[model samples]
Target: MAWQGYPALREPGGRQWEASAVAWLDGGLWLHHSLCITEREGTVDVLTLIAPCTCGRGYVDITLDSEHILMDILGDLRPTHGRFPHCEEPLDCGSVHAAPRPTGWR
Candidate 1:
């Protein structure tokens, strides 16, 4: 069970490092507190966390985390403090774990 993310590689290294079984091959998540999220090829050195399952799409909504606006992500949740499942913890309906949500406020 291995997952991976990568920066854009160059020359011969590009397209040379990809997993065949979706076992952390590509599209790894990257998180930094600075502007301009620069990247490269090769999933060997990036991706914050690997997918913990084989069902595809890590954390249920990992891809949409940073892509969608918070409000959009939230949709209609009463505009109040709600509990989100934490990435490190399993999802609980009543417990309200805090999940690693995305931020596009740039």
Candidate 2:
């Protein structure tokens, strides 16, 4: 499913990453600073999301992490809310939640 307005994590070269790549763990989840691409009307846009920490109870911005691998304890928190901190306006989390999962997703 496409989490519209959901922020992505980026690489140093400016590649976009998606939040869906994140995985839940015992306490929190691993927010991957990876890539996510979207196309509309033949136009493609890239977005970046702020990294979230498990223990701090808030989101943290990540940069220069070429490995793009960071793990934190999120506890019960999840990005179900389509509108992330970086969004200029609130997004419809409903649509994002309703969208179908990406191919090969377990």
Candidate 3:
């Protein structure tokens, strides 16, 4: 489950980050504007992203427990227009929710 060799961690450009961000976008989770691998240790990696809230005041840190699962979301998430573009109801402010594993993830 260790992701030391994951492409996102190895690559320089933001392609991998964009891909992951898009996946979250597709899954109705618009908590971040972008994602980057901030730290990698054995079976876990910390992903840092800018919050997409209208206020644009905070960052959302996501912990990937394994290569394919999202263990937790750290930091406060302000109220956004919607969790997803198509969402009719917005997510609760300052709430932490389970994020879906991205498709085509290794």
Candidate 4:
């Protein structure tokens, strides 16, 4: 199931992808992925997503403090590596190796 229904942006940088390199910061199931919003029928929920990487380097996901929550402009909440995580406060970052994400998330 290749992230069914969620909108997917191709790696902007065209670099080979590393699976499991990214994940939700909270350690839940498939929380960091481009989500398949079945309720909206094919709307990929970026809610709680990583930042839209223009550089094409994937970053790890980390929990944003309640104050750090963005208005989900694209979908839901996001902890993006956007240029402005400090806008909110108590920001966090992810640290993981470049490897395929677990198939469970797939």
Reference-based TM-score of each model: 0.19, 0.23, 0.22, 0.24
Among the numbered candidates, top lDDT falls to 4
Tens digit per residue, CA lDDT, model 4, 1-106: 1343433333545633322223433322223433344765775444344442322333335344333454342223234434223232232232332445433356
Q: Which candidate leads in TM-score?
A: 4
- Tens digit of lDDT per residue, candidate 2, span 30-62? 233344344644533322334333334344433
Error of 2 at 75 (Å): 19
Checking candidate 3 for backbone clashes, the offending pairs are none
Between prediction 3 and prediction 4, which has the larger TM-score?
Answer: 4
User: What's the C-alpha lDDT at position 44 in model 1?
Assistant: 34
C-alpha RMSD values across all candidates: 15.2, 12.8, 11.8, 13.0
Off by more than 4 A, model 1: 1-65, 84-106
Q: What is the lDDT of residue 17 in candidate 3?
A: 28
Please identify which of the two predictions, 2 or 4, would achieve the higher lDDT against the true structure: 4
The per-residue C-alpha lDDT of model 4 at residue 73 equals 28
lDDT of 3 by residue, 6-105 (tens): 2333233433323333234322333232334344633322343323333333223443444333312321222343221122234423343344354555
lDDT of candidate 1 over 1-106, digit per residue (tens): 3623333323343433222222332333222221223466423322122222222224332323343543453453223222223344554222322333323212
Score candidate 3 by lDDT: 0.34
Q: Rank the candidates by TM-score, best first.
A: 4, 2, 3, 1
- Residue 8 error for model 2, in Å? 12
- Global local distance difference test of model 2: 0.36
Q: Rate the local accuracy (lDDT) of all candidates.
A: 0.31, 0.36, 0.34, 0.37
